[model samples]
Target: MNIRTAAVRILNSYHHQYFNYENKIAATSDGLKLSGKDRDFLYILVKGVILHRSYLDFVIEIAAQRSVKKFENTVLNLLRVGVFQYLILETPPHAFTNETVDAARQLKKPRAIGLINAVLRHLLLKDELKTRLAELPDNESLAIQFSHPQWMIDRWIEHFGIANTQIIADFNNSYQKIYFRHNPVKISWDDLSQILKDSGYTISVAIDSPILFFSTDTPGELIRSELFNKGFMSVQDISQSLAVRLLNPQPGEVIIDACAAPGGKTGMIAQLGGRESIVNAYDISPAKVQLLKNEAFRLGLDFVNYGVADARSGTFPMADKVLLDVPCSGTGVMARRADLRWNRTPQDLETLLVMQREILTNMVNAVKPGGVVIYSTCSIEPEENWQNIEWFLEANPDFTIESADNFVEAKWCDKNGAVQVLPHLHNETGGFAVRLQRR
Candidate 1:
């Protein structure tokens, strides 16, 4: 496809804020028809725009002499992609404007060409995008600096300090690293590393324990290589690897991976504890259950029983250990899911946190006496992580703090008793986890 067509496709895929890296790339032709160069450039262009979107909007809203809130969503997203390249990625000024103008025209937005042309020239001549950004009033500055909605900034400011709100936003603005766990039960680190390297994967050191960072644009399907298919490893975040490890499933125990799909964590429990521990994994979505089934099949593990059941309203056989990697605002994963920043809101977290708390309560009830419950999220917000766990503990004093001293950095003191991982600081997906033991 031409540059204009690519831009148009990207614009059409962006659901204002509900977009994700997967969604943006899902419809693209992955077959051999598209040249490798075209495919590679497509990823770079899409990701570059997605990563720098907030700042790009700040520039567009400035040049237009209008409130960003008033702009058409499609026009705004398309222009943001254009301006992002011309400004941040340093695409040629002529090509940037011409391609984007053509894209706008193709979208039945013939009139927007002038607007797109004017903004690109203004940016190229003045190059004041940064200077203009520096002049935003405190409120607007906070919004842009963090790359979050002003409303979210205010909500975060009300909760965490202004400094912390700024920190949170900055965390959301970058591309996230790749993290996956070494399923020691299947293959040792030494063998796994060799298998990956021999197969042409670039490995980077992230943490000394349990996780490995391998960079490849090879579709996730490549992970199904002979090594991975032989139950050697599974792809998962560093925090999630830690969460399941901390759950510490032992042989002969039954564990329930609530909301388990894609089977990353579930696969770990099976591989970690061996054939003695039977894992009954549940996900509300059938699609996710299939993901679990695929992962289990790939891992060559027969210990995991996959099922589609809503943890919120469904009953299941009792489990000795329960892991609820519940859904939340996904603030912690914005770097990987670059399109999520625009999709999330303070309201969403509020609603999701309530469900998270309820899920925690259910998991607590689900586990047998003396069993453990590890509650986790790919979200960094206190509402989703700390407060919900705090409420769970407050209601069930029978559960006592099980030391999360095994956390990557072990700094839960200020986090109200949960492992809170941040991106700007940790260089991994932002996440949180709390482990509780029934006394």
Candidate 2:
């Protein structure tokens, strides 16, 4: 199949099976034996459609003069891909229209061929599309412009105000950089940097971290290289690494990663704390726990003990530090995970809050007296970050918020002393972490 057909199939899998777009893209790319350029084009088409879905749908409805809901899933996706090419990628009108129509025929959606051509032609004929989009009310306009859910835009406006909300939306729509955390246990920062530089990868360190580095060059080669497979480096965002930095695990301390899976933090803890520290990591999924175990082995961090257990309820060994990097709405990394904005709902936030609280409450008992429990999430929503910590503190008076200033730079922390990394402000993925100490 052609790259465009493969892009449509990946999108279909994401829509029908609710699978992650990244995973679906990877699997489809490999199955098709796509060349580098073909794979990149496929990625652009799928990711572009996902990132600008709302705007594309709006354009489709306007040009077709019918709601998008009436189109079959196949036809709808075909139109989205076509419109993305014409509008965002700015592929020439004739080229994109003809190619998209051909893709529909290739995918055996012959019925959509005429419709696709007609709508795309209609879109070309309409010079007032941009004007109409701009004329929408503020929230509606921002939602379509940024391809975010309107409710999400409303929530951000309520919490961060209109100006910051626009900034956040714009940031989320920008290109997300890939970051990798070097394993100090196996390689020093200088050695890794020199090696990567000698290999022609332009690498830069994160603002406050030496071990965390990012490259403007595509990470495909690095990720597939022996350096990553040998566990000299692991993919992790600087924002996510902040929680581990705040924990500051000591040589003899017992560290518990309550929701560790695909164990980046767990490995970091073991690396920072040395082999003497016992790191116990647990997650609800057995497959994920195995992934954590495999990662530990790859990193040569044999001291980490892995278990498959629910964090919301289960016995955990008492430890000097516990990291509860709970599941969240993932608002912070939307730029990286393009499909997340579409998959999440306000109700999902409500449900996640309850689950986050239960896990936090349960993990509190796992920390020894005077020990710390770092509550964190990759969400920018106030309700999921500080508000949850507030609720936890009010319910459990024995625990008190410790200023993150002692650990991270003051710039990343809010007035309340919690680490609040805003994507717009920090130019990093948004994340939150509060160090809570038990009295």
Candidate 2 residue-wise lDDT, 333-433, digit = tens:
88888888989988999999999999998888899999999999999988999889888989999988889999988888999988999977898899999
Best by TM-score: 2
The per-residue C-alpha lDDT of model 1 at residue 23 equals 45
Q: What shift in Å separates residue 13 of candidate 2 from its native position after superposition?
A: 2.2
Off by over 4 Å in 1: 16-21, 24-26, 35-37, 64-78, 98-115, 127-135, 183-188, 208-233, 406-417
Q: How do all models score by TM-score? A: 0.85, 0.94
- What C-alpha lDDT, on a 0 to 100 scale, does residue 196 get in candidate 1? 76
Residues 89-112, candidate 1: write the lDDT tens digits: 788988888888777776778877
Ten residues in sequence with the least summed lDDT for candidate 1: 407-416
Go through the candidates in order and give each one's C-alpha lDDT.
0.72, 0.87
Worst window of 10 by summed lDDT in candidate 2: 207-216
